[model samples]
Target chain A: MAEDVWILGIRMTKFGKHPDRDLVELAAEASMGALADGGVTMKQMQILAWGSIMSGGMGQQLQKQIGQTGIPVYNVANACATGATALRTVIMAIKAGEADFGLAVGVEKVAGAGLLAGGSRGVDGTTWTPRGPVGAVAPLDGRIGTETMPGVFAQIGLEYGHRYGGTSFELFAKISEKNHAHSTLNPLAAYRKRFTLDQIMNDVMIAYPNTRPMCSANADGAAAAVLVSDTRLRTLSLEQQHRAVKVSASVLTSDPWEEACQVLPDVNTLTRNAATQAYEAAGIGPADLDLVELHDCFATAELVHYDNLKLCESGGAVDFFNSGATWRDGRIPVNVSGGLQSKGHPISATGIANVWEICHHLRGEAGDRQIEGARVGLAHVIGLGSACGVHILEKAAA
Target chain B: MAAARIPLVDYLRLADEPYLVASECEECAARYFNHRVACANCGATAFKEAQVPADGVVRAFTIVSFAAPGIEVPFVSAVVDCHGTSVRANLVNVAPDPEHVRTGMAVRLTTFPIGTDSTGTEAIGFGFEPAAD
Candidate 1:
């Protein structure tokens, strides 16, 4: 027999530009809120898992400031999947019977620096390069090169457009239109301005195929969740009878070497593998999902994700988009919280934010962004270097 | 006139004649390119280097308009399949146009200068070009 684990509390800061706060301040606020929401004191927490990409050594600093009652803190960084990785670590600790209650928190603060502002090493023992339009800066090591994030995704759009026989503007416009409409109802979204199809089509191209509106804005924020074992919830005098969301499964996988003719399982295979394992663990399929929060770092990535997640067959994502299957009223509403496209991506915080949104929807506290009667939700996060994490959650039976 | 410093060993290989290096897993039959000391598939360290073919088709490509210092913009980059390995390299000697490139189009390798290092020495790298009929 297996013991059940439940998410008792969740909290997140509004995702946007926060020049006033650092990663620690941002994370502590969310953590404090999560503790209050769960009605659990800091002394009850047995473990703390902190996720942040850019803030080095900030997790320990935050834990100390919050006074976790001498609880063990584990810091993790997996690019965009940092948040999900932290939550998955907590789930594992609970399942292993090592911890009765755990706190998973993720925070990111994007200052004036751009995405490629950080200096890093590459595979060739050289500095990593940042790719962008004219006047891009060379990496510190001068050996590695740089490319804009949008530029990389633009390649996908170029391939998609060439294969489908449509202009890049047409393909990207559809994706922009979908996310913009979805964001109109999400007050926390960074860009709430709705976009017309014509406006999207005519927007200046950041990359050849990707326009400014089609790309996600860099943001700063934090999200946190409190997880407790079934027995622990009862012990803490927390309302155990209340509805709870159980973590069905969490899976992480890296990219595999692909042949030249084959589409490298980079994003597609990792997502499919994680999704398959999660579904198998939960005993459900894609058709059973009520809602999903995916890494739509770019519109092209979203288009590819539709087919990659097995929501549609290969090359059939456009058809699904055309039919409005991904809309809020569609069979499976995607990115209902405006997704990365509208919500803004704060890197490390993005993964935890996805979980925060799902938890809110499950608790029926998502006000305007709530999907009607959403009982189950899935969150997918992908990081650079082809790392991915997928998690599935289900609301307790009424 | 400054004399070109020649390497004692061949450090640069042509894109059309790109060097073939492979890693054969002792634990599994999985093979990889650019020499992986450890088998990623089977997690085996016992591996041997094998030769790979230089010919392959384009898997995907993009024309970059922006580039860092010492690098040219409006350049074509591609993921090419050579033998069984898919390697990413810059495509040169052809029009840097996205429309001209297509998936499954034949391509070959060539070597060119990337830039100077901190030591101020010319560094060369492999790039690709459209295959001649």
Candidate 2:
């Protein structure tokens, strides 16, 4: 494929519930910041790919709010990985010579929605039962509805505990402790308050083994990225060049049927497949990555990703964490931006937020969270079931 | 009995089968799921349906506590593979105790209900449980 697609700017809103801002308003603020950072007007954008998980409108309303004129605007909704999917679409369009400049924006405003509603129906065309043991829905029945993301992830922790000889308390606590510590440093994080392992272990259980803190908070936020082809980048003034980060590769994949039980179909094997493709496309391995942003909606998801992304071998993620391989000052410095665990998961906004964080790292502008001398970075995101998108970026050479 | 009209065919199919249902190119032997209008492998819409085996080893799994609506708390979700076909589904019928579940253990398909939509119907679905001896 073609190399050297430059990111002229990146921006994100503070991730949390914003009652005053609707989805469109949240997306607009980030879009404005990105446009200003890129020193480009909205009129110059050749294409707009808007990604949102549950924005009521399919992003046409969002585009209008952002003052997007008569450009080809495509709306994408890919659950949690929506942002990365949007970015991949932009990159693919640019590679196909479809556009010189592209914009990818992800936004979510999740509040007031009942958690136990709106699950994906089953193959026999039956709706998944919501949370809580009520009526005939026995606690032992496997047919619980979509409200089970946290419950599903908790099982991951339990399995990890079984394999590593760690207690459920130890495994889940380590993940919470690490991310909570990381979040304390992030001003924009949802749960800035840190928790002790004792607290995590003893906290009220939302699921059997998963305590409240072990889960991600649903919130409202938006993130945006501006991509320009190499041909367009060459025309930028010298001052504008200083802010650019190059896109090394972008990859997306869906899950196979068998992976559903191993991990979420969209995220499990798809993440690994996408990461492999991204690594190959970027001509680098996981070892070359200076930093990373992962979809840690639950503490267990982050631990599993340690193996799925090949940051460690299979069944070795716990040891990797215990060795401090994923810490900010540790080997790879994963989630230096404070992953979904700390930063809050706004669903669609999360994937773009990862990208935004990576761009900030590459531009050397990530402030206290910056990885020193970082040249290469990776961003990964996954939606419900096997849909996933991964992107690799490098600091633009001067 | 009146014939039941499936609420959402694609959604139900996904929930029931839990397999990435795609076509493989006869020319390239490349496999794809999600009913690709055309083969991503060799650009041919004409292809054969391939059901990836649902018996893969556990690559990774997670337990989600703070689930969205319509899902229960403390349910086990995992990624399993049978051959090259990978799927993500709920781990079912095992004891609620965490000690009983293993990553590399064998699993198979079982039916369950996801939820009814605004129509207020009982929609049944499918999930994975530990394979029986």
B1-133, model 2: which lDDT tens digit per residue? 5323232222224434454343556776665434556655457777776766655565445544544444465566665665666555567787644477667778876664445444565445556777776
Candidate 2 docks at the CAPRI level of incorrect
Best by TM-score: 1
Candidate 2 per-residue C-alpha lDDT over A13-94 given as tens digits, one digit per residue, 9 for 90 to 100: 9998799987888888888888898999788888888988675445677667766578888898787878888888888888
Show where candidate 1 strays beyond 4 Å. A117-148, A154-169, A201-204, A234-243, A256-265, B1-11, B14-35, B43-52, B67-70, B112-124
- DockQ list for all candidates: 0.23, 0.19
After superposing candidate 2, which stretches have Cα over 4 Å from the reference? A1-3, A56-58, A112-147, A157-167, A259-266, B1-133
- Give the i-RMS of model 1 in Å: 8.4
lDDT of 1 by residue, B1-133 (tens): 5423221113233344446455567777566543455666767888766555567877666655543444446666666767656665667778866467666788886655555544455545556778998
Give TM-scores of the second chain, every candidate.
0.71, 0.66
What does the lDDT read for residue B33 in candidate 1?
40
Error of model 1, residue A138, in angstroms: 11
Per-residue CA lDDT of model 1 for A310-389, tens digit only, reads 77766777787777888888988888888887788888888878987887788778898789788888889888667788
